[model samples]
Target: MIHVVFEKANVEALRKSFELDPSMDGEIAEVQDDFAVGPLADVDTEEGAAARLQWWKDILAGGHNEGLADDGHVDDQKVVRELKAKLDENPEEIVWIWAAQNKHDVSGYYWLMSQLTEYQGRIYILYLNNLPFINEKGNIFYPTNLFQIQPKEFVKAKKLARVITPSEFEVDPDEWTKLCNEDKGVRQLEGGKKLVSRGYDYYDNELLKFVTKEWQKGNKLLQQYFSKSKEITGDSYLLWRLKYLVEVGKIEMQGDWRNMKDFQVRLPGTNAEAAETTSAEASQS
Candidate 1:
């Protein structure tokens, strides 16, 4: 009975709209298990939740990120038309917005959110980076479909907006976060880094392949190793582990894995700094 365009998720607008007609309160929400199938808990268990999270991570990698940004087609009018055509109903304004997968790709999905959320009941979002990202701050930088990095504060604000309107995809925020936290582990992806941390070795054998290779090639002191984490673009878990090691002083700044601020190089290393860095780099590889 209620139609919603989730693009401009401003509470003020909703308040005005509701005041105008209380019966017509609704919103187009990000695509989530709850949105399509009623509720996450009703149909998805912890294991199902974990599998869902893992699927999200795989799709949000850089290659997919860039591809969607440049080529994603978000014709709001067209979406509006399509929705009317598909649902066979036309109730009100259509919201448009892009939804990123994770906090990592929020910056990348800002512009897309606007263009996509421009229709009624069209929660158009791409599942990149394993988390949905669309927000007011995203509106600022990605104001007119421009691509660039926005801050986390902006994302938080958009989240609030969606919360009030209640994305058809709504769930217990704490429960959702818990699911994300647990599923977002080192082994979620295939053949990236072999996490050797305590109680976190989903891909222990795979991790050994790369780490042992480096060790055989003559590296040492492989504590807290991360040789097979994720395969996403610059956001790979291996790369993150490398940065983490550097932050903790497990490695220095030179050799095959020189810790240039660039931090994208991957080569062999004999020194401890290079060895650790190299190991980190190998995780992504």
Candidate 2:
């Protein structure tokens, strides 16, 4: 177990690079050099000097997660805008984004002024993938990765790298597209390929097909569904529609939704009860 706290000075000093948790203000007073907190050679050597030193190093390195000044990261538009300018001037100045194991990626750039403590002169950035996500009936939709990253330039970089949206950096959508339609088999995060030619088993296909079908049915309806699922599809209509279709055998499933095959879909049975509910949802949406 490791414990570390970021100092107020650190947060205030590097507010440009990222946002700080307000909770850390009262807890930590000042920043301690990695060496100062590293190991207390003269203190009780319960863990021994070597172990303690290493522990200090771990604290410094891991302190970012613990709210250390050097570990501050954020997706602030202002900071990103500055970075965008810097990148525009000198893309080569950027070395690497602040990447951590199992942590969100934070992009970094070189600086001579040392405005940001964490990214003062080296890599400085947090991976930003937060787009206004719209989740409707498990099918998540958003304004596109293009709109996710701030300043918009980041989106260009991602496209050039052929990286998928945040959670799916390494996925090769192009390759996945080839697997199924050899055209639309694009991939999702973790190398998850989406296909239409008997692609992605049944459940995945069903979800994709359902979404695609909705899109194809009518652009107006699709817009309504995405802009507000509860409004257009009704609060419970989408779920009940799915149930109705599944129960009636209009859509067959070999297994779970993620792994299904040979399925068809049908609309829900609309009665006074269902109509009233859907009407209410539509009005709200």
Cα lDDT of all candidates, in order? 0.33, 0.29
| Candidate 2, run of 10 with poorest lDDT | 103-112
Q: What is the clash count for each candidate, in the order shown? A: 32, 23
Q: What is the lDDT of residue 113 in candidate 1?
A: 33
Model 2 misplaced regions, further than 4 Å: 1-92, 95-125, 129-184, 190-217, 224-285
Q: What is the lDDT of candidate 2?
A: 0.29
Expressed as tens digits, the lDDT of each residue in 63-133 for candidate 1 is 22333322334333344345445444554444434433322223222212332333424443322232233
Residue 256 in candidate 1, Cα distance off native in Å:
14
The best candidate in terms of TM-score: 1
Candidate 2 per-residue lDDT over residues 1-285, each given as its tens digit: 001112223333322222233321221112122211122232123344345444433433421222332333421333444644565576454423321111111101111112233233333233223334333344434432222223223322322222113323223323322332331211122211221222112222233344422112222323435564321212122333343445655543222222112232323332545779999999999
- Against the true structure, candidate 2 reaches a TM-score of 0.19
User: Which whole-number lDDT from 0 to 100 does residue 144 have in model 2?
Assistant: 26
